[model samples]
Target: MEIKIDDLTGKEIIELIGEHLQGMSLNSPPESIHALDLDNLKKTEITFWSVWEEGQLAGCGALKELNKKHGELKSMRTSSNHLRKGVARKLLHHIIEEAKQRGYLTISLETGSMEAFMPARKLYESFEFRYCKPFADYQEDPNSVFMEKELSHFYME
Candidate 1:
């Protein structure tokens, strides 16, 4: 799969983001949905990427810079046709690597606490992210599960 920086202007990505938001609405209450819309994803603080396989969009994800030392993962969604095919994993690995390259000391995320989010939670867990209290602009909410990972920077002599 080829992952490229996305400008959020393509029809395929727009449709995928729409599906992501719609899925979030189905699994969580309106007040608990934290997925960003097209405009928000285009913010200067966020870097968005889309994964393509054989010229078809496979998945997408984004990373938002919380500050110089911190980052947040957002809008990680595998396309309906690419579910369980390691798209999310690849996107996640890419995001974490980018975060490290950006000099971020930590990366965090907020996902739903519902059953539909189990796979996502497990994915984060596999990447060594631990549950944590709300971070950044987030507040405590029963419908939200927050997780964070510390990036270990290796210094070369």
Candidate 2:
């Protein structure tokens, strides 16, 4: 699999993002949904990537700069065809490495608290992320599950 910075203009990328949004809406109530759309993902503070295998889009993820010492995971979705194939894991690992490279001392994310989100929660846990109070402008919402992972040796880097 090849993972690289995405231009966000490719047809496959657009389709995949649409599918992701549709899935999120189906799994979580609209009022509790916080997934970013294409316009938001294109912001300068966010760096997005798409993974492709043999010329077909496999998955995508993004890192949003929250502040000098923090970053947020956004728009993480593995194509249905690639689910359970390590595509999400690869994208997640890539985002964490990039966060470290960018000098972020912590990485945080907000995912759904519903049954549909179990896999995502499990994935975050595997990377040592712990449940936390909402960070940034997020308010307390039962539908949201916040998690964070602190970067060790951040100052040394």
lDDT of each: 0.98, 0.93
Model 1, CA-based lDDT: 0.98
Model 2 over residues 1-157: C-alpha lDDT tens digits? 9999997999999999999999989998888889999999999999999999899899999999999899999999999888898999999999999898888899999999999999999999999999999999898988899999998654543
**Tens-place lDDT digits, model 1, residues 1-157:** 9999999999999999999999999999999999999999999999999999999899999999999999999999999999988999999999999999999999999999999999999999999999999999999999999999999999899
Best by the lDDT measure: 1
Give all candidate RMSDs, comma-separated.
0.5, 1.5
Cα-based RMSD of candidate 1: 0.5
For model 1, the stretches where C-alpha displacement exceeds 4 angstroms are none
Give the worst 10-residue stretch by lDDT in candidate 1: 77-86
User: Where does model 2 exceed 4 Å of error?
Assistant: 154-157
Query: Which whole-number lDDT from 0 to 100 does residue 46 have in model 1?
Result: 100
